[model samples]
Target: MEILNEQVPAPADVGNALIGIRGGSELDLDLRLEAVHEGILVSGTATAQIAGECGRCLDSIEYDYEADIQELFYYEESEEFEDDDDVDQYWVIGDLIDIDPVLRSAVVTALPFQPVCREDCLGLCNECGINLNEDPEHHHEILDPRWAALAQLSDNVAEDAATNKTSDKREEK
Candidate 1:
């Protein structure tokens, strides 16, 4: 079977994850089904337009994604494979096979756990919550509270030493 730019509802979000395909996206399907001794082998490729936020920068991202689908739908009444409990197969009802589960599995597995807009994305600034990619030079100087007293003492000591040195040089001159 061949499908051209068919609109299909995407699977639900995966546990509040950042990367996901937008719902009601266009999917192109090209599949071939073959009847085998054990079951029907389904092989196909599904292509769809995915939209999500970048995991690093949280910027909107859009891309075309393709997932390969390959699974077997076993006959429910077949007794030849009843003894084997380790076989993974989907149940076939009458002459129809549920393809939604297969499609969902394929698409989700193909997606990356952390999708980025680009490999070299600079991400956002933790202190200011600004996009570092847009302003690479943005920065903030935050001193550690534990060392604040030591930092002030060190500055005072440096100033005292400078003053002493100047006075001694003048006396020597």
Candidate 2:
């Protein structure tokens, strides 16, 4: 079955990586179902529009995504399975197969773990929380806490040396 431009609700956000699928996004599905001795094999491709913020700069981003769906929906009473509870298989229900789980898994795995707006995106500044991409020359003059005492001592020594030099020149005059 070929579904074109079918409006489907977007998937939920994926942790800090992916925000979520765009609302009112159209998903094009091209799927084929085949009945085997063990179960029905579902294979297809699903394409949709996904929108989220960039993981680095928090900029809004939208893009087209495609996922390949392929799974087996096993019959409930098929003799091919042993009486083990550890097997991972989908069971068919009364001539209807719920493809939501398969679709969700495929799309989520296909998405990038860390989505970026561009290849060379500069992340936010740690000190001021500013986007570094916009202002690459931004900086702060604050010294590291570990070296703060040493820095203060150096400044004081420099001042004392300058004062001594001026006193000696005055005495010479």
Candidate 3:
């Protein structure tokens, strides 16, 4: 058994479209490595800086995320998983265990499916791309299409009535 505490650079593409850890950023790793009959067990936590845009408001979202990492890397000559073709296995190569894939898996899975800047983000207006958070009461007064024709007809009728009333008053004078 061994304890490993170190800071390593984050691997590329450790996130989804909405959020991710930038490559070369610092990742603080605090883990334990154990040797067993099958292979080596690596369990720890990786802390990384997450940055991306919010899905709802498109605001920049930045935070620190700690992902739990636990994976088993089998020896190259080990036959423990030979029969399990469907099982994804990690192997020790040249006595070295590459934890990039493992770390990526841990971090990516923890990323939010739809990241948000805040819990109650109002988001942008669908009609005119305005941030509703800034103006909660902002809205466009859109007349219903069905009522628009009726409104136009009413205006025409009112204009004709006014014209007839003026002509009648002139003839009376």
Highest lDDT against the true fold, candidate: 3
* Error in Å for residue 96 of model 2: 1.0
The sequence of per-residue lDDT tens digits that candidate 1 reaches over residues 1-173 is 42334456665552137766666666677778888887777887877777778899999888888788888888888765655667556877998898777877777777778889999999999998999999999999999999999999999999999999999999999
Local error of candidate 3 at residue 163 (angstroms) = 5.4
In candidate 2, stretches whose alpha carbon ends up further than 4 angstroms from where it belongs are: 1-7, 11-17, 81-87
For each of the candidates, give the backbone clash count.
0, 0, 0
- Name the top TM-score candidate: 3
Candidate 3 accuracy as TM-score? 0.86
Rank by TM-score (best first): 3, 2, 1
For candidate 2, lDDT tens digit of each residue in 82-105?
A: 567875568799898887777777
Q: C-alpha displacement of 148 in model 3, angstroms?
A: 3.8
Off by over 4 Å in 1: 1-7, 14-16, 80-87, 158-173
Quickly count the clashes in candidate 2. 0
TM-score of each: 0.79, 0.81, 0.86
